[model samples]
Target: MKLMVHYTLKNKGLLFFNFICVFGFIIIELGLPTLLSQMIDVGVVNNDDAYIKKIGLTMLAVVIVGVLMNISLRYFMTRITTNVAASIRQDLFEKIQDYSHNEYEQLGVSSLITRVTNDAYQVMLFMQNFLRTGFMTPMMFIASLVMVLRTSGSLASYVLMVLPFLLIGVVAIAGFSNPLSRKQQGNLDRINNILRENLSGLRVIRAFVNEDFEEERFDKVNKAYEKSSKNLFRLMSSAQPGFFFLFNIVMAYIIWQGSIQIDQGTLEVGNLIAFIEYIFHALFSFMMFSTIFMMYPRAAVSANRIKEAMDTEPIIKSKENGVTQTETSGYLAFDEVTFAYPGHAESPVIRDADFSAKPGQTVAFIGSTGSGKSTLIQLIPRLYDVSEGEILVDGVDVRDYDIDALRAKIGYIPQSAVLFSGTIKENLRYGKDDATDEELEEALDIAQASDFVAELPDGLDTYISEGGANFSGGQKQRLAIARAVVRRPSIYIFDDSFSALDFATDAKVRERINEETTDATVLIVAQRVSTIMDADEIIVLNEGNIVGKGTHEELLETSSVYYDIASSQLTKEELGK
Candidate 1:
């Protein structure tokens, strides 16, 4: 809620002008009733036609001014609310981008998406309604009450008697609905999560013929959302009617008391009529205020969700005076590194891992699944900082280097190839923003993607579907490799990236990369024995520990773990050759 207030204050000038308009509007609205009373008592009762005309014209002018003020208020309110929402959305995105992998895992992707989109929008809607009438309601109520007291304190007392009951009802409804609103928001997150999961896994669902099952799963969440929504609306719906009922009783009482006063010659007919109008305005403003209370619970929940993301501190942070190095020999080293995922510190993922790779060298890591091969390489780029010891690039600790500067020196290709919906050229340009046609084609040629790309009707201009869904598995892998190659970074990491390609294509792509990247360090993580057979150095890992590190031939002779894996994949004669 405080965060929302901060955003509202961003356009103080507009808010100030809007407030002025609201003030003017309240004055005209509340003043008109008093003028009507004067017109009846002084003009109609006294039989002065001139007085009636003069008061009628004055009321018209005030009405015109009130209309203009309302228009001005709406214009400024819309501008402020829309801009504040945009700012909140932008800041939320930037904060998410800064979050480390830990934060991402803690706040799941589905929840983040909901906060950035739906939650931010809820705050915007509240802001729009709040500025439009939330502020003016209280002012109108108070001003109208004062005017009624001036006309007849006895009639105003009836409004005062009913006011506390109305306030108590609003408070009671808000208390009941607040928890329901939070539950509704949670239900919405669940619905979004299931929808995202279903859409992304459509292929797998069809492959397994689980469409009916998924539909059932969706129904479970959807129905929960429906139930939660109905409960919330039921509570919100009760407020308006309950308030109106009480106010109507108060209205009846006012008319009863004012009629007696008129008969006693203490209250004029015109004055009684004016008193009723002021009472309606006061009660109606309270009704509008109840709407604000109803909306507050949901907006408060949304604001808290957004604030949780903003408040999370990223675990990995560089030094304030961190070094920034653009030129390096591409020398990387791991010094007795050990790491465990946060909250599982007792069971370390990688234990006492040590390795190094210099420029012009190829280093390969081979291990069974869950042997921490991918986790080890991720540390080199500081994706997850090492729990113990340090990783260094050239001679500086990775933690001491500016994050962006360190990352820019390496081109990483993950196991899964992901591409946005855009032209092939656009995807390639993601690696090197200003890459030219010649450079793109060269990288494509090196990764062996040029042949298939050129075969397409539009070559580089061909559009890629989301996640490269239009391309074959091997084609996506090759294109992903080409994207990294386009960057020409000092270090290239292929994290099981060759799994999709056939033996021949894999061999050709590796050969071309070796030739092109003679001065850059190459690190490959592969399950295939053939892939790393010719590497300058190979590290064999088992259950988070590296048992052997050497050339392929050296490891075959000295390392039993390496021998068992090599024997499982290659024949004796094939291994010797």
Candidate 2:
């Protein structure tokens, strides 16, 4: 949090200049009342019109300079605040992109989103207020207090009596507001979580006709946010009245003393007038400080939220002297590897799992849900580190190789067929940044996506809606496959990427991929037995353990799981047809 402040202030030099101008403007404002008092005492009371006009012009000049200074300060302050907010948001976004899965899980997506959007905005507002008022108020208050004391020590006693109580009031407010502010941010994160879940699962909700249920759930979160916000603002609202009440009591003391001095012929009318002006300046300045302090707790909570994300360091890192395998022969091996998620201490996801695929050989993993099929595939690209053993590529531990070099060799198509909102060509080119039109078409033809693509008016340039909502499920899946094929990676891992496609299209796509890249290793995780029936080797997973390993014929006789899965699917020729 301190570092964020340092970085924000360091980049905003104009804000500092604006701070100085504001400080000078406040000092000049304090003199206006004193000058008015002088005009009344020296010119008007003494019947000197020239002197009145002279002091009046001086007052006008001061007012004009003060207004101009204020306008200049406001301009710079707004610019500084806006730029700082943008830079902070940009840095935060970049950090999130680089964050590892472990880091993301630790800070839930809902909280991360809230911190990036709402919390960042809160910090910006606080900084704007801090620059505009934080510095000037305290200095002006203290300076006015000094003037009041110098004018009359007796009158100074009245302010001293009330100030201690005001300080105590502010301290009490800070203590209460701090915890409430933190709670408010937590509530906001919960609201974000609720909304994110609903948005992502909107299709399922409509399919099930559960809109009312989802709305009820959203209402609960919204009500919580409202309650938390009310509590925070309730505390803040009391600050103004509390200070005003105490200052009013001090004003009564001034009136009482002024009546006595008038009877004693000691205090002049102008002196009392100046004293009243000083009291307004001093009290209001303190009040401004109090208001700023009231907002500090909320902004501080936001800062802490943002700092938590920025401070995280990814678990997976590249070795300093790691070598890049520019021309990987596509040999992948897992040597006695063990891994588990952070909270699951029962057993490893891949418990001493061992396997190897030589260049050009096809390896398949057949598993039920939660059988660690995806986790096992993630290890090849160093998405996660092995807990107890090493995962090797080309006989070297993947962790010992440069992260960029290792990932570049493997093309991964996740279970979900995610597509960005852009042209079909743009999404396909992500795998190979320099992919030409010919390369895109070649890959699309292999993935069985070229037929539909060619039918579109723009062909490869047809726009894809968010998450490929414009296309069918199978179409999105094939495009994702095409995206992977365009990379021309030495190793391809399709993690249940073909589940949506029909058996005929799936078989044709796989055949094309095998034919086009004979030297590339293919690793697949699939639920359908037919998908991996003809692979060189298949490992069957159950309860995170590889219960069976054999060819399709060997598995049918030896493994119950394999036999049952095979019985559910059609024969190879039927599936191919």
| Candidate whose lDDT is highest | 1
Quote the positional error of residue 254 for candidate 2 in Å: 2.1
Q: How accurate is candidate 1 locally (lDDT)?
A: 0.92
Q: RMSD in angstroms, all models?
A: 1.4, 2.5
TM-score per prediction, in order, is 0.97, 0.94
Shift in Å, residue 492, candidate 1: 0.6
Clashing pairs in 2: none
Residue 265: error of model 1 in Å? 1.5
lDDT of 2 by residue, 1-577 (tens): 4844675676557867887798879778888888888888899889999999999999999999999999888888788878877877888998998777888889999999898899889988988887778878888888888888876778878887888888888888988999999988998888889898988899999999999999998898889889989998999998898888888888888978977986798777777888888888898888888888888888889988888888887788888879786455789888888898766757678887888898678899997788889999998897888888888888788988888888888899997999999999999999998999999999999999999999999998899987789999899999999999999988999999999999999899888988987888999899988788778899888777778988888888889987777766767564333
Q: On residues 66-87, what C-alpha lDDT tens digit does candidate 1 reach at each position?
A: 9999999999999999998999
Count of backbone collisions in candidate 2: 0
